[model samples]
Target: MSKRYIITGAPGTGKSSLLLQLQKEGIHCFSELSRKVIQHQQKLKGNKTPWGDILGFAELIYQKTIEELKSPVNEISFVDRGLADMTAYLTSQSYFIPGYLQHFPYKKYYKNTVFLLPPWKEIYVNDPQRPQTFKEAMQIHEHLIKTYKNLSFNIETLPKTTLTKRKEIILSLI
Candidate 1:
């Protein structure tokens, strides 16, 4: 079976950079769908964005996430985020959880281990796609850890270090 290791965390964490490095090292990795969705929505001038219509944005992400999960990679792969992240995001925003997400068997699709990058204020920066403040990022980090724990996944919190060291930590753990 293809092992799908997920690297998830709040906005501004180094998830993308770490994943990129891993991919360059010949480890198959999946990019985060949220950024792609955000950029697409921006280009279309649509309201389906986290800052605009959060629920609508989540729905779009949900559909894409399902499509990606349906087709597993042939070898071990690392995903930028996992299904449970939507739950964390929605809950953190105090939005209603949709029925479709309530019944998702997340454990079946993800490996037992999930790596999480804690909020680091030193590296946190706001971009067009990510506008969440450092404080908001910390809150999201809490939600992500809580949701992952509730789903029975072993959460590994990556250290606040260089990107190379972070990648080494993950590779060593797995």
Candidate 2:
């Protein structure tokens, strides 16, 4: 059986860092769709940014996420984020969840093993793509936890610690 894991949490919570550490150990991994969409939109100077065409951005992320999930998993493939993130982002934006995403079968494609790294103000930074304040990230974090739980995912919150411990915890699950 394919074992897929998701590392999701607030922005700048080291999801990518944890995934990178696992990748270095020769594990299969998938990039986060939000970051990928952000970089792509920024390069084109498009309006599909977090502050701009958010609906469009969410749609793109949904599409990309499905495609990534469809890829045949060999051993362990860690997805930096999952479809539940779309709902959290939309909720944070005060927008109603769209019908398309509301009906998406997230549990079907995703594994029950989900690691949510809570907000870490010490490591938080706002860059071109990550413009949310630390406080906003924390708020987002709560929504994410709620989203994953509502979906019946088994959430394992990653404590603020070293990457080695994070990887070890996730590997132990497998």
Best by lDDT: 1
Over the stretch 22-131, how does candidate 1's per-residue lDDT look in tens digits?
Answer: 98779989999999999999999998987799899889999999899878585678999987898899999999889888788777778899999999889999999998
Best candidate (score: TM-score) = 1
Superposed model 2: Cα runs more than 4 Å off: 1-3
User: Which pairs, if any, clash in model 2?
Assistant: none
Q: What lDDT would candidate 2 get against the real structure? A: 0.87
TM-score of 2: 0.95
Residue-level error in angstroms, candidate 1, position 152: 0.7
